[model samples]
Target: MAAKRLREAEESGEPGRRAGGGLLPFGLVDVDGPSMVPTLYHGDRVVVRYGARVRPGAVLLVRHPMRQDLLVVKRATELRSKGWWLLSDNQFLGNDSRDFGPVPPELVLGRVLARVRPSVSWLAPAGRLERLLCGWPLGRVPGLAARFGLSRRLSPLR
Candidate 1:
């Protein structure tokens, strides 16, 4: 149903409408796997903004290239010749670009804004730290660390 809607939307040049018959700038998605662990978890509910500009390191909700009926959440790693090189944060658990290769931009449904519901309590501290690090004077630390090649060692997406 979603595939059909997406195809129709693309064909008609109107991809932002909800399936239930309304205009929604954003949509909700239920995370089902541990592929995005530490950032997202199983059962976590996320709000995705449609038509948002996707960049490297941004988490996105995309249709599986090989299986359009399936939806998966992963981080956009790089822009490849074929499409976008996406990767799972939990390298040990996900089947991502490493398995199916780059996905076309059309397959991307939306960019995840935030996790509305988290499945675990133990993971909150890490989430809080991430939010903190992405704000204020500390937000500049990641880029500075990246310049020193320090972030590559600490980032799980690597």
Candidate 2:
């Protein structure tokens, strides 16, 4: 399967190359938890761009430093001596850099461009509002949320 090949490539320290002799510059990753809350949610499918420039505030798909087989999505918080400090937008979620420390650059798989699945129409506006309020300063700025209507619908990628 593609996931198996990706894991193998990662473990081997090669860039996550696709099977069939072509480089995979992009990948689709499923969101599994509320760590990203307002920005992402359970079952949300994200488009991850491999080898993209990672910046503070950009969401990333990274291999767990201690458990490389596990991949997680988190926002890049800061550049640390080891690599990048990644944190969950939902502070209540404890399995981020706060617990595991900075993730080495090599473990970072890709930058999350946008959520693509579950379709925009399926996301309830009220649910988006609730998540925005719950996440507060980290998830959504109150003023921005009020003005923009708290929709997680991302623009289509060109």
Candidate 3:
């Protein structure tokens, strides 16, 4: 339902954006790290629908549970007894549930709908192929991957 509302606002080209004082159904957030590599890269701008439905495999914008001042983009990998178990697609570089345990649903700010930077297009949400590719040996590269445009994960967002 929340996703539908956001799509409606996007289709209507609504002007009541949260940035404009009136709250739109969705907002834009810039991706800042490689935690969601392949699916989301540094500098990518994403459409986030607040209160959108979060299910396993949804890309999410969340407040870092241990550092509320920090916002991180992660994927909902499982629903635990306590809360959502989040994971980073970039297995080699994650600071996720493995490190912080399950995250309270309250920290989930929104669901990522699409990538609007470098290009404007809807995402193939829950892309298993992309997720699989992220864990390849290349994913461990803190030095190599981003330098060669390993995937759409490292490209011009400007």
Report backbone clashes per prediction: 0, 0, 0
Please give the CA lDDT of all the candidate structures.
0.63, 0.63, 0.65
Q: lDDT of model 2 at residue 154?
A: 24
Q: Give the TM-score of candidate 2.
A: 0.66
Give a tens-digit lDDT track for model 2, residues 103-142.
8999887777666777642111244454555485746454
Summed over model 2, clashes come to 0
Off by over 4 Å in 1: 1-16, 19-22, 119-158
Per-model TM values vs. the true structure: 0.67, 0.66, 0.65
The lDDT, on a scale of 0 to 1, for candidate 1 is 0.63
Clashes of 1: 0
Model 1: per-residue lDDT, tens digit, 34-113?
Answer: 78765776777776677777766677778899988677888787887778888876768658887888899998877777
